[model samples]
Target: MLLSKAGVTAMLGLATLYTLLPLTWLLLSSTKSREDLFGTNGFALGGETHLAANLSHLFAADGGVYVRWLINTVLYAGVGALLASVFGVAAGYAFDKLTFPGKERLFSLVLLGVMVPGTAMAIPLYLLAAKAGLVNTFWGVFIPGLVFPFGVYLARVFSASYVPDEVLEAARMDGASEFRTFCRIAFPMIAPGFVTIFLFQFTQIWNSFFLPLVMLSDQDLYPVNLGLYVWYSSALTQGHPEDYLLAVVGSLVAVAPLIAVFLMLQRFWKSGMTAGAVK
Candidate 1:
């Protein structure tokens, strides 16, 4: 019993360390100067207290291009995630509850979309966007992101779990319109699922890079992820190695919002998962 317990504890400790190692490295590395990045112990602080300096440079660099990217990122992720969640939940609920001639076929088509990787469609999406004159614009990123297959899948599962037919029937018998029933009754019941969908879509849109890279050529429209990549690439090729520190700092700053968002909505995430499992 002692040996088994010790072995399990050892495995858990190793897993925890592995999970935390990259974040710890990033935090320590972001605080270091360019010179110290290579020379000093990776986990130790550097001699120069240049974190503030690096942030100022990151914000002010190229006429505050990073700020523009930050704004663009917020707009894309915020709007895209909102629309994705709303549409996903609405469609999922409709498919589950409402009868239609081709519902199954349409849902099968949606499932097929999930099987297709986003990367494979990048060039095609770019071509379509270019033809529609949306290339290099915020709409180019926003529109494509709103079409999330996985969000739809999550919504379908969530709707099936949280929404019951008897409750819907009760609302209908109370003379509630279909829209009213959904808005007042079904929505509240599925609130946790909506929040879960929102968070998932938010993370997906925020972390997306390849689609943005393919669609937008304008640096002013870049998201933080793409913006950081630009700086990293510039540092690699241009010999202005100090940009490295700025990139690291910017990366740390960029991730802060995602962490906060997850922490705030974790209850919904857990509840949604449990609801689905129990149902």
Candidate 2:
């Protein structure tokens, strides 16, 4: 038993190191000047740290275009995730709690959607967006992100697990309408699910790259991921160290929000997982 416990601890420590090693490199690299970035060992600290200058140059590049990309990313992730969570939760709640014509069939379709890869659907979505005059616009990226089939699936699971049908029935007996019952009783009961779906969708939309690449033509509409891609590509093509440095620093900055968000909502996420395990 002690040997088994030691083995598990060693494995977890190795996994943690593997996960954090790249981030550690990025953190150390971001603090180095351009010369030290290319000149020295990757894991070692720079002789001269220019983290502040690197940040200034990162933001000040090309008339503050990185700032625009950051804003666009926030909108694409934040607004898209919020809308997706609300819609997914509502749909899930309805799926679990209510009966209607062809309900199971409809949910089967949603499950099918979950099986379809987002990359595979990107071209089709672009075509649809083009037909709807949404291509090259914010809505092109924003609208597609709002349709998170996985979130819907999770919501249904959560609704079935977290929300009690007896409470819903009691609410109905007390003269509560369906919407009110859902709003007052069901929604609150499934709060952890809501947070889970929100975090999932938020992370998905934030890290999204391919869809925006296909839909958007204008650089101003680019998300941080795409923007960093542009910078990284430029660095390779033009042999520009400044652009390389910016990309590295930008990557570090981009990861911060995801970490912050997970840290903030980890409590609800853990509860959701616990409920699932119990169920």
- Best-matching candidate per TM-score: 2
User: What's each prediction's TM-score?
Assistant: 0.92, 0.95
lDDT tens digits by residue: candidate 1, 142-256: 9998897777777777678888999999989999999998889777677777888889889988999999999988888899999899888888999778777778888888888
* Model 2 clash tally, residue pairs: 0
Worst 10 residues of 1 by lDDT: 46-55
lDDT by candidate, in order shown: 0.85, 0.92
Which parts of model 2 have CA positions greater than 4 angstroms off? 1-3, 47-49, 271-279
Candidate 1 matches the true fold with a TM-score of 0.92
Alpha-carbon deviation at 75 in model 1, angstroms: 0.9
